[model samples]
Structures are given as structure tokens and as C-alpha cells.
Target: MRKEKVHINIVVIGHVDSGKSTTTGHLIYKLGGIDKRVIERFEKEAAEMNKRSFKYAWVLDKLKAERERGITIDIALWKFETTKYYCTVIDAPGHRDFIKNMITGTSQADCAVLIIDSTTGGFEAGISKDGQTREHALLAFTLGVKQMICCCNKRVIERFEKEAAEMNKRSFKYAWVLDKLKAERERGITIDIALWKFETTKYYCTVIDAPGHRDFIKNMITGTSQADCAVLIIDSTTGGFEAGISKDGQTREHALLAFTLGVKQMICCCNKMDATTPKYSKARYDEIVKEVSSYLKKVGYNPDKIPFVPISGFEGDNMIERSTNLDWYKGPTLLEALDLIQEPKRPTDKPLRLPLQDVYKIGGIGTVPVGRVETGVLKPGMVVTFGPTGLTTEVKSVEMHHEALQEALPGDNVGFNVKNVAVKDLKRGFVASNSKEDPAKEAASFTSQVIIMNHPGQIGNGYAPVLDCHTSHIAVKFAEILTKIDRRSGKELEKEPKFLKNGDAGFVKMIPTKPMVVETFSEYPPLGRFAVRDMRQTVAVGVIKSVEKKDPTGAKVTKAAAKKK
Candidate 1:
């Protein structure tokens, strides 16, 4: 009688730079080998990629190199054979965003391999100092992974109950991570956004591919505030689409936020068509399109203009090339639709409005302010004005990543030395602009169209919350509710509503509690969108419709700036 092979799932986890992937690769090479067919598959791919070597080791080395360079391979499982069993390994990334993925991966694990870098400060910086390492261990123990092998450098230590107890005890201090983990268990897949760079036949595009709804306020609001197009990737499986489009799901929120934040173009990609019932059912596609188009219309996007592309992200169907699987539907491939998007007009001709993120005082350099140029152009030796107090100074030099730049355009984060501004004179939240043009000023009050997303109580007059806009965080009070309008049509519903509740869309005038610069969304978009944060969470988001500028006088003009005119 032939002996049967036992199958096991293993999760490999560790802190950043702890060589978890390296150790996993080493084990795969040493303990066992992959299937012959799998090796041949890799060899075929290698040949197609023009690699001369057909060895399995070379393919593993290539994957390792990709991982070392911080390119995430999305491969959730790696199968290999041990002398005793067939092992399926899940190697988790050492980061905050992938914690959910780690947990999901760990839940299936029969055993876990914890890799720790024992070299000098590496151990201290990785385990003792990093909360993610502790979180990973805690999750492994909590998820009931039957066994664990701790690989510290070369030596391996197997400890079962005692190690679990230690992990449980040491991780009590990270109560925040614990709470988040608990919430994640309840909420399911909350993901982070990634900037995808791809080249089509027409345009070289940078896509802000959002992962999920949770923490989107911090990511989309705080980072990558602008996008030309929003691609809503839908799950086409039986229950996958329902879960995603459900309340508190990523689909609805992402679409709503994208529309509200002024993404001009939208693409609804019905993905995973290969896994759909009956395999690429046009009925399923039509049903999803019908449902999604209506939902998007509610979110203020004209569904007529949006492209609904059916694709299997995994099966390569209708993603780049045409697939016969989805032959019944012919609209556009994901790549084709991406190319069809109208290119956004670059905001280079507008007045310079660079909001200061931080002001640094270097040893050799006097005073330097680092910020992203939101509009117009920033060049060396231009007279730049700092807003709110209207402190004017000449740009001594402009540099990005220590390299000197002739000019910085919109979206370029650069640091420039100023002619005669002290460190105390400039700070975060101050706007830098062309002194000669219509410069930014302190906002006395701004009227905005606000959509309350999350709030425990009603918001009325005198309700002040911190507004995060363009590297600025300052409390702004709801001075008055101008009107409550239908979010989709922007048509007036109620005049001067006394109180605004969650999911209510209203035009409100806001007064900042401190000196802050804001611009109209029609002009400077980066300076216009604001997130309302209260009680340590984002409660609402708004776009500035109009700004009442406070004319600043007695402004200090630096000697170099004064001489420019």
C-alpha cells in the first residue's frame, strides 16, 4: 500500500526587515521541493520572460528579489512538500495595513513560523520596539495555530503554551492594536490604498487604487486627495458582491466619497467573472450593472458616462486583452477604459499655493519650509508669500530629495530656503503663494457643502470640530447652516436647518477657531477639501464652496522679496 501525504497550512510572520520571506525561501529550498508540474509552470513563465535559466531556484530567487524591493506580490499561499507533509505557507507583510490579511492567513494555519532578526539592534528594533511583531504573535496565538517554531537567526526554538502565555501578557500594553484587531474581526477586510502606475497606449497614468472603506478618511482625505478617475472593483462571486455592496462595505463608501471629492471619471469593474456561477454569466453581469449603476447614480455620478467593464482580475479576462469567457459582453477592457478617461488638465497656470507641512531649520541653511505645491509653479528666486499673516519672502532655492530643481509644479513636494524668514515666523498650516498674484489669505469664514458620515450626536451652531485640509489641522465651528440640499442634485430641500445629523448633506458656513487658509474648490482643490474630525475619528467631510478672505495688513516683507518688485 502507498503512504498518503499529510497537508498543512503554515503562516510565516515577523517584523519589517526581519527576513521572513528569506527564511521561508530557505526552508522551501532545504526541507522539500515544489511539485514537478508547478516547477515546469514557473520554468515556462521564466522562458516567456526571456530568462535563460529554467531552474526552480532561479524563480524563487526572482520572487525574493521582488519582495526585497517592496513590491507586494499578492500571492496569499505558497505550496511546498516536506518529507512528512505537504505544506501551504502564508508569508505576511510586516505592516499595519496587511494585519487583516495576516489574521485571515493565520486563521487557516496549522502551524506558524516566527522569524526574528537576532543581529545587534535588529532584534530590539524589530520585536521589542515594533508593535506589529507583537500583534502578529498575539494573533497567531489567539487564532489557535497548533504549533509555532520561532526562528531566531539560525537557531529554532519550539515552545507551545508558555510562548502563547508570554505573547498574551506582553501585548496587553498595545491595547489600541488589540482593539483594532477585535474590530477587524467584526468588520472584515478593511484595506489601505495603493498608487498604481501603469502605461496605456494613450497616457502614462497614476491610479489611486483604494483597498477598502475603513481608514479611508485618513488615507484618501490625508493622502492622495486628488484623482482623475476612480475604478470601483466589484467582486462577481455569489456572496462576494453582496458583502462588498452591503452597508459599511467598501463599494458604496468608496463610490460616494470619490464622487463627493470630485473624481471626474468612474469605472465600475465587475471582477472575478471566472468564479461567477455558470462561469461568465451575462445575466449576472447585467444584474450587477443594473444594481451598481443605480447605486452610483445615487452617489452623484452620471452612470451614463461611466464604463461598466466585466473582468476577472485573476484570470486575465477583459483586463488587458479580450477574453472569450466574457465574449457575450463587449464594452471595453479595463486597460481600454483606463485609456478612455479624459486626461485631467494640469493646474500649473493658477497662482502658487503651497501649504506648509513643516518648517525645518538646518545647520548650514537658514530657514526651509517643505510642502507640496498645490497650484501654479514654484521656481528658485521667486517672491513667495506666506498666508494668514502675509509674511513675504523670496525663494532662495528649491530642492526635492536633496536634488536641486529648476521649478516645482503642482503636486511636487519640495523644500525651499526662504530669504529672510525665521523658523518662528513660519509654521504648519500656513500657505505659500506668489506674492504678486491673488495670494491666499486667512479665511474669516467659508461656506461648504458638508456630508456627515459618522457622528454620534447632532451638529448645530457652535459645534466646533478639527478640520484637516492640506497639511492643516484646525478646529472650525459651524457658524450657520445655510441650507440642506439633496446630495445628488444639489437642489435645496430645507432652508437653514437647525441641526445636521449623520448622512445629511447641507451647505454650512464655518468659522475657523484659529488662523487657517482655505480656497474655493473651483480654484485650488487641494486647499478646498476638508475632513471633520471629532473625538479622534473622522465624523464628516466637506468641500469649500466659497471663502470669505480676511485681508491681512501690516504683513512683514522680507528684504529679498521687497527687492523683487
Candidate 2:
């Protein structure tokens, strides 16, 4: 008579010493949720501080000054329940001044786990040069955490004896164990961010244990921007997933920023595979599923629906059984591929929008704001408007995770309240909408299409940068580039291509140095997708398609009807 469960939040990130809180305290003590007399009092205080290999990272580092300065500093909530969902497990904080409590615990996660660190200078010093594992997988697809699970952690690969004596003094190949783990990433080591949960027999899960540490890529982009599907974790020994996927890899920049933050489902796993040798872990799992399906189809994804598996998360085998050492691999195990992922599909007829993000005021309850609707249906008295600051107001009440919600739909992360609007006339990327439906504009010039992915040189035209979109970031420019296409057959390969660089694929036009709003990606694909950034990476990724507006000048009634003709 009681079967309601189904809830999830998960966050955990990576880098700084990479074992992400001892593989999330050994996967929440192998799912029984600890308490064997609190792991023998944390193994008698880590064997009297000899640090008995950090007793499962002191089960979430419970600060005795974080287990005598072993690391993990803040955000570490927990809760477990599985058998089909009801998890929480945040666990962020991998050092660097507790990355703003790991971006406020990855902005209240929804999914993410990204650990990495398979020993040997730990996954090339957590993704090399000050690695926050490719900036927490590009800040979890720029704060939209569309699902990720990337584990790796090989339980400290038998404490890499001097990275296996500098990889047998450089002949163990795999590019000399990635040039001796990039020369030991400036003396690396230190880790945390741990969470745990498990379930199958259908849905309900949570797991975020991020942190890979290039000084905490802004808390791994505020915890992989709220994932939806990702489970990379390589390390199948032999050179641990070829030193985390070479070319200064954060596992290929966290699987190309989790497939450009939209995560179309993935699950590579391959972990320790019982430290290799089932014929070298099935030829390093068919050479990492043929180099991660040809680098996820050259960054657009589709590698035959993605799913590699072959687990071990420290001998748990295919991660919940099913590993007769590769009986020629048959798939589904990382908890049945996390219950076959899927999820996504909330558009809800589109239109309403939302954005905003934070406004508050609440003394008696007036100008709230918040965010997360991301498309149609809001309700509660309605009227809305918002946008680049067009204002309007009305809503009055909606709430959500805290209760009172007459409507609010599409992924609901509400807050509402509104009325005449104050708290200094609202802020945070505005947007809202619904005043009369399809009511949000501003652009004055759009067009997009993009692709790029990294710049360095050749972009042409004005090229301002910083875009972001959903929850708007702003500052665009570029002005025009019109056509360059061929991102795999869009054709047109040149109509204005004087420059474009890295993986091209243009169409351009942009503009937005100010008034933004947007919508076109065939009509609001979660605020018509975007990305761009510049000096901070994320080169490009676009959408929009068309827009213009701006007219309105009237000019004294067309100069008095042209002097009365």
C-alpha cells in the first residue's frame, strides 16, 4: 500500500585528486548505505591517521577538519533508497576553496557523477594543466547538467608505483603512458565529491560526485549543468583508457561537453575491468568502442546509440554483476545502463518560456522570479511578459518544489509571485513570457546555425563572443558570415567563408550586443540553443535561424506624408 518513491537529485563532480570521495564512499558502501558500525569508526580513524587508504574517503569526509585535512571541505548531503528511486546525495567540494560549495551543490542537481582518476598520475593529473576535468565537463554542459556518469576511479590503481616506474621507463607504450602522465600533473593528488544510489527494475536514481580539479572548473560547471545522461568512466588498465583519451584529455573534453550539453545518452564505463587481461580487457574494449565511436561521430553523437559498459568500479564487475570477464560483452549492467536512460521530452507544447533564475524579496511575498519552466503553460493568474526588461508582470503565485502551484509545467522549477514587479525591477537574464502567447522578442538581428567548438584564429567579422542562451548570457556581434555549411552535408561550403576555423559549419549573422531574448531553433528549443564563449573556451554551438524586428521610428508621420505629396 505504499509504493511512491521516485525522486532524484545527484551531483558529485571531479578533479583535485580524482577518486571523488573514494568512489562515492565505495558506492554508498555498496548500496547498503554504510553503517557497519560506521565502517568500524572509519577504520579506527583511518588506522590512527596512517590513513589506511582513507577508509572509503571517510564516508563523505565528515570533517574532523575533513578527516584531518585529507580534503573535501563543504557541500556533502546524503540520503539513499533505491529500489526504484528516492536519492539525494550531493557531495561536491573538491578543494580550491570549496568551489563556492561546488557551485551551490551543482545548482540543486538532477544528475552527474564524473569521477575519473584511474591512477598513473591519476588520469593525467585530472585532465592535465590545472584540470577540473575539462572544467567539470565544460561546467556540465554549461549548467544544464543534462546527465553524465563518467566514473573511472580504479580505486587508486594499485598506487601506481611511481606511475609504474615511469611506465617501465617509457616503453609500456600508449604514448609512453601519456608522457608519464603529463609529467605528473605538477605533483597532483587530493579528491572528494561523492554520492551514491542505485536502482533498476525501472527508473529513480541520483548520483553526482564530480570534481576532477583544474582548480574546480567552477565546481565542474556548477555540476555538469544538471545532467540527463552520461556515464563515461574509462580506465580499463593497459594505459587506462589511453591516458584518459589523450590530446590533453579530460576524457575528450568530457565527451565533447556531454554532447554539447544536450547529452543524447552515453555510458562508456569500461572501468578497471578487474585490472585488465581478459585478453587485455577485450582489446581495451574494442579500443574504447572504436575511439569513442569516432569521437562521438565527430562531436555530433550517434555512435549507434552509445553504450559500452564492461565495468568494475573496483570489482563490482559489470557494476551489478554480469561480468564473467567479458563473456564477449552483452551490454546493460551499469545498473542496467541506468535503467535505459531516455527521459528528456518535456517541451510541453512550447511557448511559455521562463528563464529569469533568481530575484527573491519574500518578506511578505512579492517579487519572486526563480526559474526552470523552459516552455509553455505557467498559469496562476498569468499575464507575464518579462524579457530583456520589457517588464509587464502579473503572475501572482506559482511556487513549486515548495508547494502552491496552480500550473507551471515543462520541467517545472518554478517560484513565480510577480505582480507589479520590484526587488529592483527583476534581473538575472530575464525572459518569462505568456502575456498573450508567443510574446518575447528583442533580437533586432539574428540568424545563427554555428558549430565551431574552439577558436584560436580566424572567425572574421566583428566576432564579439559570449552568448550562452537559456538563462541568457549576452554579448554577441559577429554581424555576418552567412554561409559555410557542410557540417556533414548541410552543403553550401562557402558563400562568405573568409574565416571560421576549428570544425567550421557556419551560417552566421548574430548581432545582439544588447537586446536579446531569442527563439528560432525551429521555435524555442529550450530558448533556441546556444553557447559560444571565448577566452574561457566553449568556442561555439548555435541555433536561432532567423529574426530581425527593430523598425518603429515613424519619423514624424513620414515627414508629414511627404509634405502632403
Predictions in order: lDDT: 0.49, 0.51
Candidate 1 per-residue lDDT over residues 121-240, each given as its tens digit: 333333331222233333333333323333332111123365463222111110111011222112221122222122344533322222132332333222223233444445455544
Best by TM-score: 1
lDDT of 2 by residue, 1-565 (tens): 0146444545554444444455445556666666667656555545453444455556665435444545454434343444555444454544443343343344444444554444333344344423344433443343344555554434323554554443221111111101111112112212223334444444334444433333432333233333344444544455434444554444445444444444344444544444544332465456545654565455555556555565544345555667575567776665655555455455668678776645788888767886556567898767766765555656767865455877866544457886655678766556778857766756788887887866778898888976756545568888879889888778897898777998888888888877767777677655666566566445677667777745223211222222323
- Clash pairs for candidate 1: none
Q: Model 1 off-target regions past 4 Å?
A: 1-197, 209-213, 278-281, 312-316, 346-349, 355-374, 386-430, 451-457, 465-475, 482-496, 501-506, 522-526, 529-545, 551-565
CA deviation > 4 Å runs, candidate 2 = 1-114, 119-132, 135-152, 155-223, 226-245, 248-383, 386-441, 445-453, 462-468, 471-477, 480-509, 512-530, 533-537, 540-565
Candidate 2 local accuracy as lDDT? 0.51
TM-score of each: 0.57, 0.34
In candidate 1, residue 301 scores what lDDT?
Answer: 53
For candidate 2, report its TM-score.
0.34
